[model samples]
Target chain A: MPAEHAGPDGPGTARGFVHHACLYGSDEEFLAMAVPFVHAGLAAGEPVLAATTPANIELLRAALGDDAHALDTAETAYFGRRPVERVSAFLRYHDRRARPGGRLRMIAEPVWSGRSARQTAEWKRMESGLNLLLAGLPLWMICPYDTRTVPPDVAEAACATHPARLDGERVTPCAAYRDPAHYTASVPPPDLPPPPSAALAPPTADLPAVRRFARARGAAAGLTGERLALAVLAVHEAADHLLTADGAHVTLSAWEEPGALVYDLWRPGPLGAPVPALAGYAPPGAARGGEDGLWLARRLSESLDVRSRDDGTRITLRVAGPGDAEAL
Target chain B: MAHTDGARHRGGTSGTGGTAGTVHVGDLRPGDHACALYASDEERASILRGFLLGGLDAKHKILYLAGADGPRGPGELLEQCRFTGPPEVPAGQLEVLGPAELSPRQGELDPAALLGSLRAAVDRSRSEGYRALRITGDLCTALCDGRDVSRLLRYEALLAAEFGSGEALAVCQCDTRRCDPAALDAFASAHPRSVEVDPLIRTAELVVVRTFDPPGLRIEGVVDTASHRHLRDALQSVASVRGDVRLEMSRVEFLDLAGLRLLMTFARARAARHCTVELAGVPPHLLHVITLIGWDRTPGLRLGAAHAC
Candidate 1:
């Protein structure tokens, strides 16, 4: 059980962070489950927070009328963006509401529209990570997937992340749910198009060199201002890790995609173990031992994808155009 | 640097005897690119005092450089050297330059750029009617801040050739109390003349250039995998007990997670004693990155621009 707070007090039990993935076909079904969960938390004077799509939030507010005002809520537009950012928001709410040995309820629905396959994979991994991050807190949470918007595969992955399934008035133990470690380790990294062979930079350990290279490529890609800066920062952070811990036989491959700067840093050395599932998933400054550098790297950029290879670890960082500073 | 012979410093001895002989600061001639290692700040100040006074007395144009991290706007010059300069210092015979002026390009640190700039400064000195241009600064701070060492060694060789033209002179200084041993050895051979001194701390993992006049620590080095315990232990024994602890970081090449945490750990510990830690000389853009990651608002920490000095 990894020698932490596992066994009786760990996730996947009645003790703490009780997560349930709700699958609903229509509005009536979503409300049938969510309205009661919120009402119960209010009756018991427990903190309850709901973050869903704007349309669903209005639907919930209309059905419960005066009672819905008691539940804290934010539209998913503000609630979820990047996986690391969304998780931080939830943790902040939990910290403010949590009491010793007490229980609270939560309703979370991630924004799924316009996500690339790579981003979808990251969201699923983060959903699974919640079990570990909140393992000791008595958190009763329901994560709903709307068939109207969520694809079947997305819903299936969401179900796999939660420990239970809530249908109608019954909450049954989920047969599909897997431990976060086992489940997250199965998710694959982003499958973006490869950079042109000519774009591969020869191995070097100079930070200034790396910065210059990233800036040139990012500028060529039409990345400017804060977006370009973040891409360079991401490249700097990831390369800094290799420079610190490895022999640093690292090559950088840069490419310009439409509206974004993508960089891949491949060092010709092994990272020993696989890149941990929880790496870079934690909030900044709350990172564990090995995940420290990646935490900042991931948060500062649009995405930081880590994949261990036979020769070395290849870190891909992407910074898209004109991003809002909403992650904080 | 090529593993060849040059005058090295033997304990308490100054001579032109063997490969390990030491030279006096006053003995430096025009066209001499000398490297010196000082065991303590007092010795460093004494060496600098002798070097600066000679230049000022000789009526040479003096170019002073702060460490790689800096008083970017100038002013922290002869004051810290604990020496007085000629009235010409105010009349434009003395000029202060930061690392930025060494290389014109923003991000890439090409040693050739530095050489070209130094050569140009020499030309400017001669055109201004000075006998020679005397250049002095903490050259080791660049290496500590992760300038390409092989390239820098090459730059030193080129600097020696440039100084050989009889228009300029430089004494590249390394504080042995703070320099990496490997870098120090490279400095000895990179120059035609070397002034090797014993080091106070033999296991210095990074270069920490401290200036009491400005009241700050100029951190320059590849502090990526630095020994945390070594850094913390040294700070505990050496950090000044009074005033705020201002860290100058313009010269730092890359600080990994552990190295950064060590700085914060030290800052927080200082904060516990009711002292605030201010980060000085950090570039605005780099400071923005620090703020982006939320380290800027860390408890007992404040962001500070480079001091005018």
Candidate 2:
């Protein structure tokens, strides 16, 4: 499970593109693996970029001395805005920096110790997506995961996303790495509990009433300030779609669970099969446009889950509180 | 027809309601008419009590026209509403009468006479130190008695016009179980505002309808993975129309990843066509979502002010 062959060895002359996860216990261990990679890339005359914590960047800068200026360093927080945005930025950087017919080198530690659960989930997806995103590009990406800092689940996810691992410079293929498409499809967020509040059934013509209902309930549930406004707005968006449709009726409910405020909108009738536009998964040619609402919802909320049955479709929106800071 | 001046307030008081979801009957200005369709006796009584109590609080002249064969008379129904203050009926400020009293002649209907009676009531209320005349009538008796639907509709329209003059407010009650859908629609269309006592039933799948005038599509229902393609197709079709496309997203309840992508794709496509895509009634959360994904920065995309309601 820790390591196992990714593919056949290429010709000695052609540059190889390796996606390896570096699992380390201490700062010294991270340096031990990272410095050599940077040295090797420099020796190979390839452009090198390091996207990690500022402290780590500083450490590497000091260690590399004059050679540090030769490598590009970007704060990982810049890329942490959202997984898709980060990938787009990386692709742009790679395209601009890569030398034609030459190799590109990148060391990315995108996930940190204190990310929200939603953030972690997106990061994992980003990792899996990179397999396809960087397939033909002459890039070798080293995704570093601190075994001491990241949760066991995230470590496991890293193993599944990368096709190889570097433990103290011993690069070996990862048997656990599943195909990107398969991995992305298999890992879904857990189902949330039903909203505790009773559903507010408002007629299509009475959308204002439903909005008022949601705002009041959201306020009563202690969602104040921007959080309260966001919760109410989220509920309004969901209720608006249901009430305005040609449906008979729709019910909206909101409740707070431990560290998150949740809203559930239930509308009767089948929604057919899952549509690609709403999947939020980056499709082929996705760089152009699509899944705007899904992306917005996911980015705004801590988590969003949609369940559709033959009789009805229920959408649950959850916003993480300060207390629910365990990585997504 | 004599009240053409009242048309100025036609759309003004059409959708106004009190805060906290309460229908403050007294706060309704003249030319304001509301429909209260009830499914059961309890709901009817609750609505009537709220309207009467609000009128009483505002010192308006209250008139309750009860059905002829109902078990409880207007007086009994008023008592059941549990008024907080002393009874105002005997002092002449509140009047509870049967539909027969309002009829031009015994067991007969006269639309013109009824209009004259309503006008007379308004004049008397203003002159007798009342703020306004608030009327609640149980139209079920008239409809059940085989009264002409067109005549009833004409009377309702005249009443609306009369109220439009800013002299009175009317709450016409119809028994949903007794009235057919067509008859109900006819009555509802005559009034500016309508309220149904029964809870709304939930529907499956989101419904998208293309609107004319400003040219937009109104979406309702959950826009998740299962329904995003339909939404994309709808938007693509709408995009084929020239000029700007307005997306009325206020009614959409749940927009998942796929839904957002479709919106972005449509917006981008429209931008490519040199057409702007405007979004109206976007909830605060969606605005936040839009901001988060930086979709608000998409070219040729304009987001209208987020409506609180």
Candidate 3:
């Protein structure tokens, strides 16, 4: 099924807020979309950057020749590791290159290989989210996807996330571009296997006990040093937030999932209000969304998914292993 | 766990209610001899300022007995006290007596002789037309050097009994960093009251201590939802303080996002007024979160080594 709305080209694909999905099957095709994008920005004195895989950056550099000197490039693997921080990195890069009424042109490529199906979708959500987040800036961004590297459905996400598509000849409006908020709301939370009965801790509002239990679980999951600290802090924040909202006890279930530690916090009663689509993505000084602790938890952990189900809210927080940039 | 006062080296929350069953130094009246188990000279100074300032403000006689083993002598520490309110202490109303004058400055401490001197001072203050006599002894060793543990306990008990129901109030200062746990506990039990600084925040999970000199707060333990408002109130209490407001957090176990957000809010607010909310010894993990969200980038917020020592 389509991840978002699909239709014909419209004003959404126009020059203003120029965001496009650039699908390429080969190196030559990637350059065909990237070279012109970089050159056009350089010609107009706009800051041009390429945050993609090295091979593609090499291809674009080879195609652009001397003009590539003015371009900035970052490995997508590192640059887009954590979604919230990725936004900050991008905004910082753009702000640094900003000019008076000028613009920035960036070639962003989401790291697709080695990502779980759910993670791939998260990347797509970040892509769609960028359209709204960076709309006011005179920024032109193209999200390139190697159709050969990703599954058919994963490649199709680009169409739903971007306003325009450049699969071959020219940049045409993406027929499947849904609104960012609409797409984010429709996306499903990552799958978390039910914990072994022994892994579940009894529900309690005793914060100190909960803290010790969660810290022990995180350490047991092989998280250490800063990763362990981040996990513990994120858990404390989430549990504390729930306690504050409902003034109730919270159940915690934690287990190791491959290279990550997954924690599920179940609190009774419906969490007030729908989780805001842009929650936790707001920067420090920006207008905030949702609870501050939860917002920070989303940034601290690998991912935070708040789901309203089972007559309550289950907030899942994940923290990835060290040096696993892709997982981060 | 154990409501152990003085030996609070471990991270624990501070409540507005002061330490369990303790009285604020400002609340101490004549006939009250309170034992204060302090962790640092910094902490002792906080209690001392409140103690002496109250006496000075009331035009009462102030007798400061400095510890012989303390880093500084009575005369010098008195010069550095900087009571904050009164421009200068009345020369005749204030006296600096060290352990040398207390128990003969030799042999074992004589609890009887010390009581006689304290009694005489109380009588002298009354004769001088002073409203009250305030006696604060830094017994961290200055006065405790030659005395055995039992003798020290006897001296403490006698001091409390002799000063009780009189025009004199005694604040016995025991340095937790230097005093033994058994002795510290005994010292605390001797007096009818123990002194606290009117805790900015004291909860089961977190404690916030206001500091002078650098002028900020010393936060300990976890900051969760239950204590979030206390943390906010504590920050606001020091918001109007000029210069850098140092937040000492080495003992803090954890702080929630709301607590962190409140810090950034205050940090930003202070920035506009040309003041800084400097964070010293912020845990490495919390520092990462602050920097990760760019809260550390706030103009008036300096993280790490701001006043490291």
Which candidate should be chosen as best, given DockQ against the real structure?
3
TM-score for candidate 3, please give it: 0.71
Ranking the candidates on DockQ from highest down gives: 3, 2, 1
lDDT pick, better of 1 and 3: 3
| Ten-residue stretch with the least lDDT total in model 1 chain A | A1-10
What's the count of clashing pairs in each model shown?
5, 43, 14
Clashes of 1: 5
TM-score of each: 0.61, 0.46, 0.71
- What candidate 3 gets wrong by more than 4 Å, as runs, is A1-16, A167-169, A181-187, A190-193, A202-210, A219-227, A240-249, A276-278, A286-288, A321-328, B1-116, B119-134, B137-198, B306-309
Residue B281 displacement in candidate 2 (angstroms) = 13
Query: What's the distance in Å from true for residue B243, model 3?
Result: 1.9
Winner by TM-score: 3
lDDT of 1 by residue, B95-158 (tens): 8777677656665456687778787888898898989998877757665555336765876777
Interface C-alpha RMSD after superposing true interface residues, each candidate, one decimal: 10.7, 13.3, 6.9
Q: In model 1 chain B, which range of ten residues has the least summed lDDT? A: B1-10
Clashing pairs in 1: B8-B20, B76-B309, B144-B220, B144-B221, B145-B221
Runs in model 2 lying further than 4 Å from the true structure:
A1-18, A26-28, A39-48, A81-104, A112-126, A129-139, A151-157, A168-170, A180-188, A195-252, A265-271, A274-290, A305-315, A320-328, B1-291, B295-309
lDDT of 2 by residue, B9-41 (tens): 111222212211313343455556877766656
Task: Assess the local accuracy of residue B161 in candidate 3 as a C-alpha lDDT between 0 and 100.
Answer: 70
